[model samples]
Target: MDARKTIVIGVANGRGAGDPACQDGPEVLRSLKFLADLEQTHAGFSWDDPIRLAPGESSTPLDAVVQIGTQLAERVCSHLRQGNFPLVVGGDHSCAIGTWPGVKRVLGDKVRLGLIWFDAHMDSHTFDSSPSKRIHGMALACLLGIGDRRLADVADAGAKLLAADVCLIGVRSFESAEAALLAKLGARIYFMDEIRRRGLREVFAEALQRVGEHTAGYGISIDLDALDPAEEPGVGSPVAGGLSLGELTEALTQAHGDEKLLALEIVEYNPYRDTHFVTARAIHDLCQSLIP
Candidate 1:
């Protein structure tokens, strides 16, 4: 946040979800000129080459993810080494399998990594726990080093984030196994109900403080579904009661220019589901608010 130019990395992958249409998300946003104006407006804004799966890499979904994820990890790690902030735009939440690991590898072993995940669902499922077996639902688990070996062991051999250094906000949907896993690990989760009672501003500030504890820095990953579908329904998964744009945007501004804020990732932007580009604009504004 020290006025460092932001490097936008687009992850053009959708193999982790049931619908693979979002693999085209980064390209769609690029071609449609959604981000064209940002480059003109901010001197610090520019796009890094989008990450995509090479042909013949898809022997299996798992194989495809591992391939792209490895490439993405290298890309993100290289950017961090250059002292630019990495803003990862995603094809699906599964790109997280690479995002945090890249950040952690750069931070190294002595310092811990902290994350704030804003999503409608817990995104904490494991292959054994998930009924759908969609890897998108298991991103947080993978980031925490408890899912498939390929994902859990992304950068190092173990976890990218400790449960104590992580926080999940806007979680209204989750199954028992993932819930038990997080609960057993003692991760702090401010569910939708709690946010409703205490308010997003307060909750987000507390979450920021929670993740900031005993860590080098923290990052935020937002799933578009975390915003209420009635207000913004462009994501692949929509929840009825979720965060409002006004509140979320205002809350995000509080973190603006915070040097401790390491990286930002916003994912699950299904342009096909959008109603006249409302969600696209949401993505635009969200990034505008937080980028250093």
Candidate 2:
């Protein structure tokens, strides 16, 4: 097996989620020396220093989001151009506004990129559909070319990921408006109940086949909240009856070395709500599973 060269980018802006504590997530993982530990655990894997956005760029949340998104896109595109896997650790799920678009930008018009979103919430709300006006909740919608133009056009307006090419996994919480939009858009969703009925491996295999069948490659955006709060308690948005850690890790491990897995983002880690770094450790384990 060839060594996997990965680029780790960290965005410490919590303004997108309307929660400041999430900004501390990247620092928490860094402070714990997570990357060094990974290097020691796995051979043929190496990571670059995390790219982070500067603080106090703007007081207005949208402006801050755009700034971070622009910088993140540049960094991610650079890594992709260098033939490295981009592993993004976020300030919140909102960082996804930049993550996927960056991948799309690099792949350009010829490649159809599928997106697999693993989250407790649907995260498909538009500005009008969102009751909280939180960008974090509306990231998937934007990536699919549906939300505010500012966000939806972050990477390349015409290069949006198609809704049909996207799949939502482990979603257990959502508003009626978001659900209606997803149904209208004809998006594929694998709720926790369906996952349980069909079996995790079966459901994930189907999802992978669906997403990768028509696309050149796909990106995975994992919101920690997708896991049961009992298992991952440090997420900003916690919902009960989410996927178990074992199930998620197993899926990731199964998909680990697929050449079609182009990008990965793990978001919504709030150390303030955690007990004994459980969330961080879980993230570390998941990263381990992805390492080649």
Candidate 3:
């Protein structure tokens, strides 16, 4: 398989973020014409239209999120089967509820998978623990097989990731219970303070090593909010102190060269909240680095 063969899955479900504007995340990114721009400089890249709930589809918020997840799972799985890497862009963090599971589905139950989550929140909430009860906040929990069974079943095989194989970075806005859950699950969290102290290069090198050591490969999920609000202000949940655009871009560029990097997903970008397309331009640059 050609390593450059890439499939882009755009998921436009905002129910998880509880912000209707987030549903336009994909469209916002598309408006930048990143793929078209990439084709001029790179080869073997293709894109699919953003996935959306059908007209008149009836489902609760949780159910709708899960459904979109399942749809994304199918797309990711198919791309993987053909030996193509799946790059998913999302309406919210909840898109991981399906993205990671789709990777697991492609690998089957016998193989183990790992995750590297770059985000401001742990995204480990449950209905019982969530202050807002938004599905986006609970995505990582669902991926680790801790939330509702409906979400846990998104992969159809089982939980897409294991706590021992997962790592979270730039976490500075999580609920107390969410932090506790990460501890209970044994997932590593690299808070903003540590990243600032150790620096992004060292921190990201450690993260890649930790997640890559035990598994065949790992899927990386980047929530735009993981970056400082000043740099990526258009996220669904913005945190004040976070990684800088240069730090994130440099770290990601280094990581993108890994042969064990199986899939990539970027989420929670809200164009409506952006000031003069700062977030959109950042997203465009990030995609350019990864695709080329």
> Which candidate achieves the best TM-score against the true structure?
1
Error of 3 at 171 (Å): 0.6
For residues 1-292, write the lDDT of model 1, one tens digit per residue: 1767789999999898899777877777778878778887777788899998886573577776777788888988898888888988888899988888999999999999999999999999988989999989999998888989987887668889899999999999889898999999889998999999999999999988988888999999999999999989789788889999999999998888888888899999898998898988999999988888
The ten-residue window of minimal lDDT in model 1 covers 55-64
Candidate 3 C-alpha lDDT tens digits along 109-132: 777888889998999999999989
Q: Write the per-residue lDDT of candidate 2 for residues 1-292, one digit (tens) a residue.
A: 6355766777787888877788888878887876667666666345555545564454577777777887888888888888888889988888888888888888889879998889989988888988899888888888878888898788677437877888999988899999998899888999999998988888888888888988988988899999999878999888999998888899877788888888889999998998988889888888877755
Q: Number of clashes in model 2?
A: 0
Model 2 misplaced regions, further than 4 Å = 42-53
TM-scores for all candidates: the values are 0.97, 0.95, 0.96
Lowest summed lDDT over 10 consecutive residues: which window, candidate 3?
Answer: 34-43
lDDT of each: 0.88, 0.83, 0.84
Per-residue error (Å), model 1, residue 233 = 1.4
- Model 3 CA deviation exceeding 4 Å by range: none
Question: What's model 3's TM-score?
Answer: 0.96
